[model samples]
Target: MLSIMFYIAITAEAMTAALAAGRRNMDWFGVCLIACVTALGGGTTRDMFLAHYPLYWVANPYVLLLVCGAALLTVAIARLVDRLRWPFLLLDALGLVVFTIVGCNIGMEAGVHPIIVIVAGMVTGIVGGILRDVLCNDIPLVFQGELYATVSIVTGVVYYLGLLAGLPADIVVLIALAVGFPLRVAALVFKWEMPRFVFDREMRK
Candidate 1:
């Protein structure tokens, strides 16, 4: 079940990246590259931070192939996808939830502290989108006061607490996803945001 979720998450992420690439008028190679980065960047970063050997995509090359195929499909259906903006947002939200759960589990398996585990989840959930936005030359949504990163962190914390409460793994995963997906979608619909930092010019001096 977790493996299925992981595959869905990466495919959704790849599609999102491919759409962004198309928006930027990138070629097929560029689209595929961005898609892979968006799908795997977070996991790679999390693995590096944990000093885990053999990054996931490297260990399972099939994951890369999966992402590439998703990207290609996105390019082929780019117009249809563009017309279905809500579907993209929904898929992205789902991916965020899945990645958070996966990251949290990985951290726990690594025997990290609970707080660090939560942080690991947040990193894994958001870093891929961050890299995608950077490559696409847009301000990353997380930094723009969107609820994106907040949802990631909160989902991680919820999952962590669920484990501490001795919940079944599947139940914990479902609970985390249930909490995150609505929160993210509501935030998008309501334009919910954290207050942006504002530094006065004189403060800089």
Candidate 2:
């Protein structure tokens, strides 16, 4: 439910990014296709592995329409897009946060252990971007040592902990988002990154 909307939002962001990069034209079909695949790819992977049956959009066609309509709406905003990069990032973060929460939920429902729930949440967050980058032929932002996937993993940990504390589902998701999204934005703003390997010496030396 909410997870699908998260995908729609992510799809919208990535579709517009693709359009801006000229990888995809701002046509109806292109918009819809990119939106659906970009948004749903990660969650779909998780669901298939967990055997969630019939998949999400197949179980509810409205979600498909939601993604399509979102892409169409994004076209109108194209004029002001140059002024909206932060908005795009914010939307992308929200979508990631939402999907992370949903993935955590699925993990619990599937009877996964706590550590595995964290893994599931991070996978749900990252794999979509991986698919999006691969399809768009862009360098994956996730692997740039940036704080992207790290934030997702942190949020997933929070979700599992909150779940163990017997928090309400809505509260658990909200906590995860509240913690996760801003950290992601801050990481982007400050260019926060994890240290890369130096091989203990310069390779060129």
Candidate 3:
């Protein structure tokens, strides 16, 4: 079940990234590149941090094909996708939580410290979007006071604690999703954001 959800989340991420590439007027190759990065970059980053051998996509190279296929499909139906913005947003939120859970699982398997587990989950959840935005020449959404990384951290904490309490892994995953997914959706609906620290003073040359 987790494997299925992971695939779906990556597909959704890829499609949305393809849309971003389209907006930038990128060619097919560029669209595929962006889609791959947005869908797989987070997990790749997490693997590198943990020094996990044979990265997820590296071990399962077909995921790259899946991402690129989803991206090209999105290009074919770009108009329809553009109109279903809310659905995509919700899928993206699901992806965030799922990625966090997966990352936490990897961190636990690595026998890392608890703090590192949460940080690993967060990096897995947000880094892909950060890479996407950077490649697209825009400010990363995670840095824009959105509730993205916070949601990942919360989900990771809940998941880790649930497992620590001896709950079944599947149940822990569902519980984390229940708590984190709603929090993110609520943040989006309520426009909840972190308070920004703006320093508008100009430096003296």
Candidate 4:
């Protein structure tokens, strides 16, 4: 899917930036490892789930080359990162939207209903990040950011609705990306959070 490809591209770029941010003393292998995990990990999980064989990167090994180039390109542009923070986040947001769309598409192809399509979409986006956080030994934002799964869920719903409406694929991708990306960004900027206490803690009589 075009959406998934774009998501991979965006993730590669963001991973390159992050590695550049942290790779001052890291060896070349370390750089490549980070780039690979960040870019390919999520899509790998998605494909594995759908039993989509050969995997996207394996079919097009140039994707690995593309990721490598991105990481190397970062070394030359490290100074620009200060101005590129917002861009990185936006790219990441795009990846999230696009990957979810691809996952839902796969679910539809598998004859899954709308609700499972939504869950599949969210799983595609979240699982890799969960793995990444575990590797990095940090708190996964999916657990901490109240908006995390909420954004994925909302975007999944949007993708399903767009499909049912028979919107052109391009339009659906654009609108979903536009809607989800900003909502996530706004959550970050405003520190907006879903209420955790909405569920009553009191034991019922």
For each candidate in the order shown, give its overall lDDT on alpha carbons. Answer: 0.91, 0.74, 0.95, 0.72
| Candidate 1 structure, TM-score to reference | 0.94
Q: Tens digits of per-residue lDDT for model 4 on 1-205?
A: 5746674655555464345435445666666666666667776876787777788789989878877777767666666754677777766776777777777887787677778788778877767667655555666777874587788889989878987899987788778877888898888789898765445558654
| Collision count for each candidate, in order | 0, 0, 0, 0
The numbered model that scores best in lDDT is: 3
Pairs of residues at least 3 apart in sequence or in different chains that clash in candidate 1: none
Model 1 C-alpha RMSD vs. true structure (Å) is 1.8
TM-score of each prediction: 0.94, 0.84, 0.97, 0.80
On residues 1-205, what C-alpha lDDT tens digit does candidate 1 reach at each position? 8778778879988988999999899999999999999999999999999988799999999899999999999999988877888877888898888898889988998999999899889889999999999999999989989898899999999999999999998898889988999999999999999999987999879
Looking at model 3, residue 47 earns an lDDT score of: 97
What ranges in model 4 sit over 4 Å off?
1-17, 20-26, 195-205
For each candidate, C-alpha RMSD in Å?
1.8, 3.0, 1.6, 4.3
Q: Per-residue alpha-carbon lDDT of model 2 for 113-163, expressed as tens digits? A: 887777777777778777766666677888778788889899998888987
User: Which window of ten consecutive residues has the lowest lDDT sum in model 4?
Assistant: 12-21
| C-alpha lDDT (0 to 100) for residue 132 of candidate 2 | 64
> In model 2, where do residues sit more than 4 Å from their true spots?
1-11, 14-21, 24-28, 198-202
TM-score comparison, 2 vs 4, better candidate: 2
User: What local lDDT score does residue 123 receive in model 2, on the 0 to 100 scale?
Assistant: 74
